[model samples]
Target: MCVQAISNPRSEDDQEKAWQAVCPLVNQLRNYYEFSIALEAVVVDLLSVLCSDEMTSRQHLEMQQSLFKQFAEILDFTLKFDDLKMTNPAIQNDFSYYRRTLSRMRMAGGDDIDKDLDVNNDMANRMSLFYAHATPMLRMLSDNTTKFVSQNKDLPVENTTDCLSTMACICRVMIENPNYRSKFSSEETVLFCLRVMVGAIILYDHVHPVGAFAKSSGINIKSSIKVLRDEHPGKVEGLLNALR
Candidate 1:
């Protein structure tokens, strides 16, 4: 219902209400492992809506803060979800089942297709843009989190550390897994991973007292770099650009 309301709001007020209603739900749902795929689909849809060019300038201005908050929430959930899925093999099985079901529904010309699981072309395009190197979402995450830490000096750094560590882990997993590396056929996907890996290292350095390069850092930076160097010898330019 919240998704429907957000997608086809009857009024500007209604749209705002829908976003307000769904933001917390998005945040909460990340903790539930069984709903990982559902949460992933919802995040993609919400991002497409949030990043749409159809909104008027005035509406965009009015909702700027809300948009940032939503993006932060989405980013947080994404990192947490990625971390969970890395440890749980069942998440992939669940996603495979969903794909099979969606495929069957498409083949049957069924009207009963699960709207939540099915991503339309437009949404997929927007999702692609979101992970691109030029994405505004990355800038937003950097700016918002920097400002947040500056203002909230009393807050614990553990959460931020965990987020960065999860990013590093994701980068490592992608580099180590041949199947995952094969999926990075697009330059954008490769750049996206490089950017995350680089950003994670830099931020992890700043946040962790001993730095991300320390022996006790837990993040295997040396091995990750070695794997990238050995496997992706051709992506040197992309890696340099990402580091820069």
Candidate 2:
């Protein structure tokens, strides 16, 4: 089902229909009680198709919008803020939801995030255009995930670790997309991306102990942070310190 639908969303109607079919599954998958690496991999692989470099500019833009809209559906399905998850003694199920969602978003925004090879001629423009469609959900999801992680201590290390990794990807995309770079200074997207990066670094260090954020995220978050440091050093001081 995912393979056929994501194979090529060439039209708006097809995109919407494709999301309608899968959004429920995505919602159900988000709140898994146990962290199954297999199911997570499957979700990542399917969403990667929409966010991959293997599409036309038009298709990319449509697919990004469709993906986020589907995310909003999942958000609507369950935005539980109560202590039910904590008291119920099922933090894994509750916390894994945010971890999974952020992981998926990071993967989706990833094509142009860190890979220099992904950019060629018209590719930068395509990513920037896709960003315009992608930023709202990206901003919302990252912020919510960060907030949730900060509040919950017993959640698995994977929840916080995955959140940081994904945020790094998002920051990388914001910095690299030249078409949208002009908006970097004043855009909420830029501010949120930086904040998320800082949070990710702190979380990574706390969770992994010896694991370095720069080496762990590899190119995606590192290059993205480099772009910010080169362009706006003062604004990114928090992110810089967190990396160190």
Candidate 3:
């Protein structure tokens, strides 16, 4: 309902209200791992609406902060969810069930099926792009989290350390897996992986006592770099840009 309101709002006030209502739920995604697939769909829907050209310049300016906040949350959730899914078979089961149900609904042409459950072409494209590059979103998250930690020095270093470590590990796993590396068919996706890997290394170096270069860091940085370099010889510009 909130998504519908935001997508087809009668007024600017209505859309803003819808977003306000939904933002809290989005912020709590880490607590709702079982529903990650469904929640991901919702997040993608909202992102597509916000990023679409249909939004006016005025709305873009008005919602700029909200948009960035949403992006950061999406990035964090995507990484965390990917990490969890790697360890938990249940997450894949949930996604399979979701796909089957959606397929059944389409096959039956059920009028009773909620339109919101349907993945429109635009939303599908957005979802693919999100999992592909998401560099812009990662940058937003990096900037916001840096600002936040600076403002809240009293925040536990352990919490920050764990978060950055998990992000780095996830990036390494995705890059090292041959199947996953094969999916990086686009330059954009390759660049996204490089950016996240480099960003994670830089941040983890700062937070981890021994630094990301340490063998005990558990990041397997050399192997991951080797995989990327061997698979994407033409991505030298991408790597250079990531370093920059």
Candidate 4:
């Protein structure tokens, strides 16, 4: 499904075709382990598309919400599948990650707090453009998933250590130049990407901790952290010290 989305993407026809190819897999994802992990991959890809600075449009935001609603339904439904046995590490891990992510999204959307007009518009625009291009794939994923994650509460997090580390790196980058980070306002977008990266790294580290990141990337991370501290003392001294 992922390969098809990348290899043959141009028109709605292509998108729908690719979606159809993967739509049948949802029924096979009967287990919580399969469902949550797959859902995580889908959410990450969708977020990457929506968060990119290059594509900004209203259509993308609507699509993002549409995708979110679908996933939410899936997760919500899936939450009821099997017993809520916190003792099962797989179930626990998947549930935790889902809750954390959903909470983050809702918070970012300002569902609870009062919205800032400019910030909201910027976020909405970026998300919309992302969905315009990525929705078909997400739709395919939505079709494939059997369970839905609930939105009223937080997405779960089985392990937050790597997430914390990635966030630390992101803060370092943002403090260096919060004003010019991405297409959206420089400040929060950096934070948002940091959050995603952290979550991804956490998942990766869960599988391959020692080499989760390339040596080059690690060096870059180390160097970036140093530069941030040296050039932007106020931003880095307190915030990104843990990243290194």
Q: Which structure among the candidates has the greatest TM-score?
A: 1
Better of 2 and 4 by TM-score: 2
In the range 1-244, model 2's lDDT, one tens digit per residue, is 0111233345768755654544443333233312222333333433344334455424544557665334323322222211122223233332233334334544878635334322322433332332233122223343444454455455554544543455455556766778766776665556555554554454455445355344554335557557667756655554454345
Per-residue alpha-carbon lDDT of candidate 1 for residues 1-244, written as tens digits (9 for 90 to 100): 0111124446758745654544443333223422533444454444344434555423443566465345445554444334343445433333333334345545776644435332433333443343232323334344444544455466455545555565566666886678998888776565456545665665566657687778998578787576557645554443433333
What lDDT score is found at residue 139 in candidate 4? 35
Question: Candidate 4 lDDT, tens digit per residue, 81-164?
Answer: 311221233332332332343345467675643252222333433333422331222232333321212221142221222222
Count the clashes in each prediction. 0, 0, 0, 26
Error of 4 at 3 (Å): 41
Clashes of 4: 26
Where does candidate 1 stray beyond 4 Å? 1-147, 231-234, 237-244
TM-score of each: 0.38, 0.32, 0.36, 0.24
Against the unseen true structure, what C-alpha lDDT does each candidate score? 0.49, 0.43, 0.49, 0.37
Instruction: Give the alpha carbon lDDT tens digit for every residue of 139-243 in model 3.
Output: 334444454445546655444545455555656677677798788787566556655566656555655568777889746667756655665565444443443
What would you estimate as the lDDT of candidate 3? 0.49
The lDDT, on a scale of 0 to 1, for candidate 2 is: 0.43
Candidate 2's C-alpha runs over 4 A off are: 1-156, 182-188, 214-221
